[model samples]
Target: MTFKHALMAATLAALVGNAFAAEDRMPPIPADKLSDAQKKSIELLSEGAPAGGAPRNVGAGPWVPLLRSPELLNRLQRMGSYLRYESAFDPRLSEFVILLTARDWSNQYEWLAHQKLALKAGVTPAVTQAIAEGRRPTGMTADEEMVYDFIDELLRNRSVSDPTYARIKDRFGERGVIDLIAINGYYSMLAAVLNVAQSPLPGGAPQQIPTLPR
Candidate 1:
């Protein structure tokens, strides 16, 4: 082959390689081609979305894969709505649990969505930073510390210790305890969905959660 032709071919090959490397792990299902079930899921999600619109990530988020089973998606959406908007725990505490779950899963998209909300809901910067770095945060309020410890143990040990259970039970009551566990389980499920799908952050967003070193 001629030298010029060889160089051009090599350059084209390099560009294709780069594009493939950067491609999304799970590309979102295109809106135009959605199944009836998928379309219904979007409609339900849009209805419940906070005032302006559905979250940017919803199109690419777990909801997409979940579209395969609209019934399951519907139930999850209702449960998620309650956990996020109507839970007995205050927004701050709810957001804290979300961040913890996001970090545990190394879920970049979940972290990107919740990190700011977590701050707005009053989780301190120090605590968020520490969680992102896989360390126990300093200066937690009594309630925050109890929650952090409870979730940490639950995730690591798969069950709370007697003392941890007693402490939370005393402070939050039986219903609150149930809600806490529900929130943890719900968000953990979301983390798994996002991780499995390799969901991407919204355009131009950076990955806020760093993967922890083994």
Candidate 2:
């Protein structure tokens, strides 16, 4: 096949796979078929999106399943807009937290979506690769390390240690601390939805993060 043809084929295959995966659960609803509330949710999701950002379709990432509950989807997009774009942490650190949450959840779609964002936001390739492999990434800056430890302890222990909490609060302020916690919780909630939905990675990409042995 020609390169263009090959790419188209891959995309079609991926769509087919996603259809099969989502049909029994929260299947993608076509725009034309969406209810008024669902359409509103899509509109809200698109309100602040960049000129050429992610698709406004129900099939895009978490929106597919989330569309089922338009109010939830709308609320989530509002909250996510703040956490993703206006969070106290730098974009690099925000994306690093997102990637870490994705890794922890083994959510392939989440990882696929944010890995590039993480890199583009200034997270080093080495750090991302280490996180993908479930290792303590070396070379993270002091702040990055602190953020990592904060989330790591929170996820593993169900609460941040006193020291970890203090470090982030000192560095980023109480708002930063709250944003940090909110980002983790927010992404984790999305991960749970995607996991329950068995959302496939876009374009038939192979899973990047390995499932932990448990």
Candidate 3:
């Protein structure tokens, strides 16, 4: 396996092994136990979610840890609203970036939640599967390839190379690039929260990402 693949394998193995034990690291904040600030955070988060209600409880998932800082949670929720619904890129492209971020972090909750949305957003099975397997996906359009490369370089290097930057900037312009980076950074933060929280997939939901070759 390549270095990236090997690293991913190691990370996944560690996370999988600790899955059960990590649960207590950050327990959910019960509604009755929520501070006034946390309640306000939930209200903002819920409003930013879909019209019906938030996909998951604000007291659950990554939101649990973030609840400790209600102001931060509120800001994050607003940023998340824009990235998810109002970004310059298409929803499919946004989802692609999120999936790659999810995989890089080996964040089970992130991967599980976005896998279906990625598919619905038209990220092909081949691309998602290849990413899950830690290989560069095949048969992506120029746009997909550009997005993949940009995200890949950013994750691996902490900055994009000049050529990659120019290509995306030319095609997407400054606002698009900013939005792209924002999505990646935001989701990565959420991944960290989820990882630390040891948030599991809902009940019996199967893990979508497989363990990579060690």
Ranking by lDDT: 2, 3, 1
lDDT agreement of model 3 with the native: 0.81
**Candidate 1 residue spans exceeding 4 A from truth:** 1-25, 49-57
Q: What is the lDDT of residue 186 in candidate 1?
A: 94
Q: What is the lDDT of residue 87 in candidate 1?
A: 75
Error of 2 at 58 (Å): 4.4
Instruction: Estimate every model's Cα lDDT from 0 to 1.
Output: 0.79, 0.82, 0.81
Candidate 3 regions off by >4 Å? 1-21, 48-56, 211-214
Task: Put down candidate 2 lDDT per residue, 1-214, tens digits, no spaces.
Answer: 5544654564566456544555426667866889999888877776655433454444567888898999998888878877887789878999999999998887877898899999998999999988876779999999999999999999899998899999999999999999999998999999999889876666667756666433
Best by TM-score: 3
Model 3 per-residue lDDT tens digits across residues 26-124: 667777988998888787776646533235566456887888889998888778877887788888999999999988887778888788888998999
Q: How well does candidate 2 match the true structure, expressed as C-alpha RMSD?
A: 8.0
